[model samples]
Target: MPGASAPPVERHGRPRNGLRVARVVARDFDGHSETSLDPDLRVFVSDLARPYGLELREDLLRRGVGHSYGEMAEELLAQALPAGEPVDLLILAFSSPDVRPGRSAAVHLSRFCPGAPLAFAVCDQGPAAAFTALRIASDYSRSGACRRAVVLAVEQTSLHHRPAAPVVLPDRHRAVALVCEQTDGDEALVRQSSGAVADSAPAQVRSEWAALGPQAALISGPELALGPQAALSGPEPEREAGLGRDPLGPVVEAGPGQPFTGVWTQLAERLPAWRAERRPVLVADLDRRLGRLSTLALPAGVAP
Candidate 1:
């Protein structure tokens, strides 16, 4: 019984496309924040969370400043999207709850960004939202339906509509804006990936590592459960704050602390170094619940 194995993972991929990440910006929110939901909207929020088995903070709903996707997206609007930069599509991807459940944060955000880009949100996909956003962006770009796109992967720590679970919320409020542009460039390459499971993560990661040259590196999210497999491949990993490297390649990891945003945030932080070193980077994260895995292969060097 102890030796019983899990089901095999369904894996498939398409050939590379022109979708390249032009820029990546990650923001973390702390302390009290401004309000995006109006006072009059309090009544609308009343008991709406009941069906989901969540408890709402009545006091906060009435009059209080808390983190919100709309508000956060508003602040990131300028930085995430530059002034007068035309965007054809905007997507807000998140696993966490938004303060104003009544509002569409992505659609509202489009008003402040450049151009009348089609705006929408990708939620309830857990951490896979980032990957889904990239895939969608790629599809749009490939079909020539959109030239430029913005994918805002956001998560807030404050769950006003509290959950019964012990601690399902992220440690911090994080928003990662990925600007994707279609061009004949040698960078920001993203390949569509599907069917990721714990049983297959290590082998999948190793296969990805095998494809990269010595200079290239692979960073896996903590949730993928690659550490134990990593140990078998090489020396025990340094699992305190983050993951350590193995001999097969630069197999690093984002700590489990950040949960959803860890790997993406790490990509934002390490992109410059990797580019400067002329080494490609592959970032992988797995949704244990859905048994799905997403990998973003960012080529080395700036796009032409």
Candidate 2:
């Protein structure tokens, strides 16, 4: 086990963000191949949908076509979480509804996971929910309420009912788990939420990244792409990837099909390479309908 408490201070010539992410892992699921939902879930969804004059479709109720958050978290944790490693906090963030309804995956995960830490879920805020979870985890460590935290961001493409308006869904089932731990540094990770709305999100994201120089990168979600041109107004990534381009460095975005897990998936895939290059990273995501924007700024070369 790692040290429990470490003051947030600059260490090793690097501005230590309050939280050091020990591990980051993500996976994309092809067609929903999980077992079928039991009778309890079907009854729950059927009653819930009655209010909108919607009934459960036979296809939606079939097996091999849906996902359970609990199941997905289990898989990710198995890959990222070490055996018998105690966790101080566990948070689940998702934009899509899990196949198993009326059950809290976070709480359920706590029971099987080592430490049985405080657990909960954050949702309905779209991509910003993950940032919110990260911010909360950082606050817990800073306040001395926790020693380590795990944040699970999961999104499934299955929506059993029709929406009043068109919604952006992920291309496939995907989930990312971030094991964020306290660093003995005296500084905190940069996290901001609710300031930028749908209209201003792009400008804000661009300005923030523009100041990071070549040792930095910004990975953003599709929600921030609401403006005329969401891509950062800078040179190609090949140039800014330490090749000498705009100060904004490189911009990686979640695609339209992956409205929720896009940015996170990108981060999970590219974190290692960026860490090797010693580049600090920023993740900015938004809940366009809610007009809320959130950003998570990480120090260079975060662990694992």
Candidate 3:
């Protein structure tokens, strides 16, 4: 929200990188409470054996993770927008189920964005939905469809599936909002894929990058398992314990959820490092549920 005062500029009357990224902010659930997964989903949790503890059935519930979807999303947008700056579009990428029945949540959240920006939600796309949203944002910005855009990704782990059905439970509640306009910055959406993988994804991404001829520094979700020689292998690092001591000042912390939000949150926190490196940043997210992968590239300092 720091540097959002100026309107986007066009070069030769065409949108330039000046339609750039403004802010990337992440918020976690207010707190947590010990709870257990539904008996049906419990078996799946037991099999994973992660964060396993205490009573055979009790699991930690990320309470207040999302008090109200619309409110939370709007608050995050406000946090990213400078006072009185209008957002031209709002893109909501969500992987979790909502208490409401339709995409009205996104429409309501757009109120916080001001300027009557067009808003919609991209759902059922799995964890990679955020990348999908990014691609959508890129196209809109590139084509001059919108000068100012906001991408919002929110995830909550509570399940509303059948009692015996398996469900994906996030470690915590989290949301990330990224502000975008046109810019000449190094960042730009390169390639994105969401099709079924015929072979190893690591190999696929590596091959794709090799063809493109630019070595990329990949920042990816945990799902894109990579090995040595893989194209800029992007693996989500474990969450750190302390935060305020970083050389770049306090680092934003990462909470739990689908790997998509986890990787995105971590990316937001690492903006300083990326800016220092002055290298390209590739964000790759995969939705294991749909066997889909979504990726996009950004230049250094895209977040700042």
Candidate 4:
């Protein structure tokens, strides 16, 4: 491990201002056809807005390409604050975006809520994005950059649908939001273990391997309710062999199930290590396809 690269450093320091979650509003495209409004998105937005005494605006609709991060941001902002008050923070969560090269949410925020502080976080698929937004808002509060923040997470898994292949769609689209406010009390969720493990870390290797054993189990789980195994096969023999040297090197690719299984496996094994190390961990599983969305948080009492 001597030459092993250290995990990327997180920006840790006092926040510029006492921050808090004021409100959260999110939307998804669920129960709606590819050409219709994703009902799940509307429900998500409604849930967050209602709790905070807000309502969804007609202008704020899910639109644009399936990759609608910018569109979602604009819609959420419009619905959350119809009167257009100056916002302190804005966080957008999405699985995909219209543009790959630029941060679509940031771009949209710049145009819609230009003066507000902005942050973006992605999650594992869509449901997880809501959680990611909460964490991002919490980080902002901890940083003291803002007093109130808006968080939105949306996902569209429909793109993965392939008629030729046996597909497992779990209500396909979901969106959620949270409003975070700075608090002097204890954190709602303690940060446990954070920092990225190298794609070569032993922990990472064990996780990927353990995942192979349970991939079938996940596909068969009643919660996920995926049907018979599709024609999809495991990774090529040559690729599978290469994984040992670089376990995180992206071998053994399959559907979403494989990567998710690997991450849960990693968390199950690593969380205990973190606890043994005296860290209170919160596991964040992000989109493997998007990369680096996963995070672990060790709470205040935990050791560095």
lDDT by candidate, in order shown: 0.64, 0.67, 0.55, 0.40
How big is the RMSD of model 4?
Answer: 14.2
lDDT of 1 by residue, 1-304 (tens): 1111122223354433456777788888776455635664455455666667676776665555457788777777688776668999899998876766567888899898888799988878777777777777766665556788999988777656556665556778888888888765543433333453556655666555445554343333211123122223334453321333434445556666566777778777766666666566677776766666566666554413
Backbone clashes (count) for model 2: 8
lDDT of 2 by residue, 1-304 (tens): 0112233445465543356776688887766644445666677777878888875666777653677888888878878776767888999998888888677889999987778899999997777677778877776676666777899999887777666677776778888898887776423354454633656655666665544444333433211112112333446663344212334445565667777777777778777776666576767766756667666665564333
Off by over 4 Å in 2: 1-17, 30-35, 62-64, 186-190, 214-247, 301-304
Off by over 4 Å in 1: 1-17, 33-48, 52-65, 162-167, 185-196, 214-245, 301-304
Worst lDDT run of 10 residues, candidate 3, spans 221-230
Best-to-worst ranking by lDDT: 2, 1, 3, 4
Root mean square deviation (Cα) for candidate 2 = 7.1
lDDT tens digits by residue: candidate 3, 66-140: 234675676677677757578778888886655343337888876767787999989877766666676677666
Q: How do the predictions measure up, each by TM-score?
A: 0.76, 0.79, 0.66, 0.40
lDDT tens readout by residue for model 4, 96-199: 32222234455456568635556555543432444445555665565546666666555444331123334334233434444445555324331122234323
Residue 224 error for model 1, in Å?
A: 13
Q: How many angstroms is residue 107 displaced in model 1 relative to the true structure, after the best TM-score fit?
A: 0.8
Candidate with maximal lDDT = 2
